[model samples]
Target: MSKAKKSEFRPNDYVVYPAHGVGQIVSIEKQEVAGFELELFVISFEKDKMTLRVPTNRATEIGMRGLSSPDVVSQAMKTLKGKAKVKRAMWSRRAQEYEQKINSGDLIAIAEVVRDLHRSDDQREQSYSERQLYEAALERLTREMAAVAGGDEITAAKQLDEVLLSRAA
Candidate 1:
């Protein structure tokens, strides 16, 4: 058997993982595992105190991707303001589908989840699970957008909301 070639990853790089949102690459490390050496990219998410080690070469295959471009993030923000598409399906089924999209690490897909699940101030109440998923998607999308725009998450989120609101009106 042959060892796989390691792809180069740098510190301060923004990356997205399926379940976790955007994270910054802290370091690249080589460690011995079962008498073999493995190279890993250390990624950290401050919001969760979670660290992930992904094999350099396996990053893309596992849906790990760099921060989306500013244009891409802007497009996703526009998506948020678009008309909501609430399915007639059961809540459980819809929630599962939304979770899958979030974990896919696709900004547009995550934005779709956020848009469809978002409730306006005057809207009816959202179920606990719905609220949780909505917040998660919003956070994930905003973090990446902020990184791309060279701004903080709060600013990015507010910008996104502004775009959406303007589109809605």
Candidate 2:
């Protein structure tokens, strides 16, 4: 294992894999692959019902990171309460941007997607694509929130929804 990744992450830690949301590092495995011995971090995603083994050396390069600190989560919640910035671009372009933000593994960016796509009681319903993107962003944000705050995803999601809905009112 590289010196950098040797102590960067540990088993039982909650990490955010850019494309996979939150997952737990179950263990570190040393295995021979293609005639070379490799050290891997085995991550399990309960929500996705999947397991991912990432080479320890490549974890940082691929944006595998620890959960956001409480301060950062607070900032993201503040972002959720802020005004939504709807762009004048086409849905395809906007969707691409939202996906990029969500995959950036930044809690505040994901929160922005949730804030903008969130529909208020008086607002028109979201289109199918918009709803999909919104749900994706919400899931990513809430999962991180739950991991950081030490509770379940459902409670975390409800707390975020309360923040958004209260702001709308």
Candidate 3:
């Protein structure tokens, strides 16, 4: 690898880790490991109360990405307003797919999960697992939305609720 280090992210930048949703890059750290210098990004997930250290060289390789752009956010919101698509696959298979989508860290994919799994008041009740998946997806979607809009999760959630409720009508 060339000694030229071109980093696209800096401290305090919000980024999404595929498996961990959104986290802020608190700092960039350089440590010596096995007689070699390694650079890492120190990320903090406030909502999950977790911190992660990922090698800077592996950020993009591991699907760590910056927050969604405004257009992407709008596209995700449009996805929420669309009809839900629940396949006829078995529940277990569908559950696994939903989990995969949640962890993919793709805003639109997460939005689809939230839209499909959402159960309005009059809709049939959801099972325990279903509710868990929905909440997980919702949380991921909400966090990214909030980060993009520079608002709190609660406000983002309310905006999402309005969109979903309008879709149901």
Query: TM-score per candidate, in order?
Result: 0.91, 0.95, 0.95
- Show model 2 residue runs off by greater than 4 Å: 1-3
Clashing pairs in 3: none
Q: Using alpha carbons, what is the TM-score of model 1? A: 0.91
Model 3 shows how many backbone clashes?
0
Instruction: Rank the models by TM-score, top first.
Output: 2, 3, 1
Cα lDDT, all candidates: 0.85, 0.93, 0.93
> For each candidate, how many residue pairs have backbone atoms clashing (under 3 Å)?
0, 0, 0
Question: Per-residue lDDT tens digits of candidate 3, residues 27-62?
Answer: 999999999999999999998899999999989888
Off by more than 4 A, model 3: 1-5
Q: Which candidate tops TM-score?
A: 2
Please report how far candidate 3 places residue 152 from its true position, in Å. Answer: 1.1
lDDT per residue (tens digit) for residues 8-85 in model 2: 999999999999999999999999999999999999999899999999999998989999999999999999999999
Candidate 2 lDDT for residue 10: 98
Alpha carbon lDDT of residue 65, candidate 2? Answer: 90
- In the predicted model 2, the residue pairs found to clash are none
Lowest lDDT block of 10, candidate 3? 1-10
Q: What's the residue-level lDDT of 17 in candidate 2?
A: 95
Candidate 1's residue-wise lDDT over 64-169, tens digit each? 7778877887788778878999899999999999999888889999999988988767779999999999988888888888888888989988887887677557
lDDT (Cα, 0-100) at 97 in candidate 2:
99
